[model samples]
Target: MTLGMVALVGVGVALSARRSGREASSATRLGLAVVSVLALWLGATALLASTDVLSFRSARPSPWPLLPLSGIAALLLLGRAPLAKTLLANTPRHWPIVAQSFRIGVELIIFAWHQDGRAPNQITFEGRNFDILVGLTAPLVAWLVATNRVTPKPVLLWNVLGLAILANTVATVATSTPGPLHLDWPGAPFTAITTWPVLWLPALLVPLAVFLHVMSLRQTLTVPR
Candidate 1:
């Protein structure tokens, strides 16, 4: 599922570049390559988790998942540098925002995990996480931007809202997991997220969602008045 979403984003990026009638610049290529590498690394991590090669069920000072999460965060911070800013600015403004639609799938996966008794309800849409709304409305927001029916201000606000939801879920997942900061819950903690496929939730999808929101906000804020 994660790979499919990554491929979709890659296709969107390629199509956007084609529609713009310009070849991808070196920086754009580099950015895409970096994302591709991260996706591959996440896939490998999932495979390892599936085989029981990596486990975070026990309470530890620092879980192995934190490594990838921190790496992704570092990459996002680096993306804010001048070169990455130029590459992202050259990309279609609507692409990143549209990419957020994948959150719907992420939410569905969480729902399934909850149903299977692997995840807690607190992180699912049925619980405190309202991130599904952001995912569901992503297409509409993208359409508004595409058709010029809305100004950058509204999109900027939407991005901020999306970011907040993303952060909320991240925190929920972190605190709910069986880690040093885990909360004492009645049912099973969020151990599934530390396993196969679901691991991509924090390792890859969350970071990508954050990157999209940040890039969208930057573009929206920099739009000419």
Candidate 2:
């Protein structure tokens, strides 16, 4: 799932670079540079997780919160960069909508983790997390946009709802997990997320999903509807 998230980011970066009006070679280099940086970042995150740097006893404040916070900060900064602006201006508006389908896999993994007893039911589809709905509707929304059956207004609304739901899911897990913000809940704690591999769910996957939705909103809002 970690590698898949990285690959998805690379795809978005490559597509954006290609459509940024740069020459093919320059675009390819730009894409590679952005993707390489993200790959390296993920590698470091994974290493930290392996060393138990991201995890701690359930009674203590987990270092895991820092990972998602840092990732979100980086993404926000990146979104303000010239490259991101160019990408928003050039990339097809529907691309981000389509890209959101990746969340299906994310929810699936969470569901499986819950079943495996690694995660809590409160963070799964059967629980408070309804993020799977956004993923399931992504294809339909993209198709509506493609067929001109919906305007940018509707797309923007969809993005807003998606972002809100994602934020809810993040909140659900953060509170349910063993951390500074931990909230008491029934069943097992969501300690699996602080471990290696699974840590990427918050560090990479959630942040990437956020970026996609925010970028899609930017693109849709600026369209000459």
Candidate 3:
């Protein structure tokens, strides 16, 4: 699932760059840089997880929480960078919204993890996480935008709702995990995601989701009525 999501994000960026008005060489270089950055980010986070640096269940000054928080902050800031501005100006409006369809796969993986006893029920769809709804509706919303069947205002509202859903999922996961923020649930504390492979969920996927939503909103808000 991690690899698949990573690939989907990378491919989406590459395709957008290719389809944009930029010169072919420039687009290729940008795409390669994006993929390289993603690989490096994953490698660094994986190293921290492998060395137990992120497993801070008992540590007072834990780096675990700060890692994802800082990552999310950095990604949000990146949305305002010149490169992001150029990409947003040139890329198709529907692409970012459509890309969010990957969330369906992520929700499926989380459900599987819950059934395996690796994740708490509280973070599953049967419990507090209804993030799957965003995934299910993303494609239809993208189609509406592509065909001009909906106005930018409604699409902007939908993106805001998606952000809200994402925040709820993040809160649920944080509270369920073992830490100072941990809230007791029916089953064991959610710890599997703090390790390698699954660590990418918070480090990469969630932040990427936010970046896409912000980019979509940025584009939608700029469109003339």
Candidate 4:
């Protein structure tokens, strides 16, 4: 389900970049961007999972490779804007300062919930809430910006919110356990809301949601330098 969402996001990115002012330039760059990021992520995920120091969780380390890779890919995409200046042309994705600031805001929000009392190592209601928040915010913000309903000025906010959601989800998975036990019809609030699945929502759904949001952000929004 999540992989499907990630693929959908890829389509969104392709479509959105095509409409940008630097269409021709973005074409080559976007290809390199996606392909390069994928290669890096998969390659790294395989190598690092066996390492002892960087080990994330004891249960399922499969997604361990994805966390850092995704984080770095996003960080690169946000940071390396200047390199893509020619590709951006009128629709500049330039938001270096804004992106950094947004990332900080998102991180603070993630950590804030921890300040009161940390949830268990298993699935967290707090973490799922963040993913849903980004899922709602990213697409809407993308639509608003693309339609000129809002300024391209808040690109940083959108990206920050999006990536922060991803980062924090990964953080939770790394620290929490899968809680080997399962309950039946527990009348959990999350079950009523349909946000909580059996296992932690972190690895199962959040990655795909994060990618979907990014893709939606690209497809629904068009900006210029």
What TM-score does model 2 achieve against the real structure? 0.93
lDDT of 3 by residue, 1-225 (tens): 666666766666666676767677777777777778878888999998898667766565345666678778988887788877777787889989998988998899899988988888989899999899999999999999999999999999999999999999999998888777888778888888778777888988888889889999999999999
lDDT of 3 at 212: 88
TM-score of each: 0.84, 0.93, 0.93, 0.43
TM-score sort, best first: 2, 3, 1, 4
Worst 10 residues of 1 by lDDT: 53-62
lDDT of each: 0.76, 0.83, 0.84, 0.42
Evaluation by lDDT, superior candidate among 2 and 3: 3
Off by over 4 Å in 4: 1-33, 36-40, 43-83, 90-129, 152-158, 177-225
| lDDT at residue 10 of model 4 (Cα atoms) | 44
lDDT of 4 by residue, 1-225 (tens): 333333443443454467654466666567556655645554454454345433323554333434545554674475347634332342323212112223233334334434534333123434343544553454456555555676644764666566775676555444443232223312221111111212213322344344444533453355453
Candidates in order: C-alpha RMSD to true structure: 3.0, 1.6, 1.7, 10.5
Best by lDDT: 3
Residue-level lDDT tens digits of model 1 in 68-87:
57756876887778756655
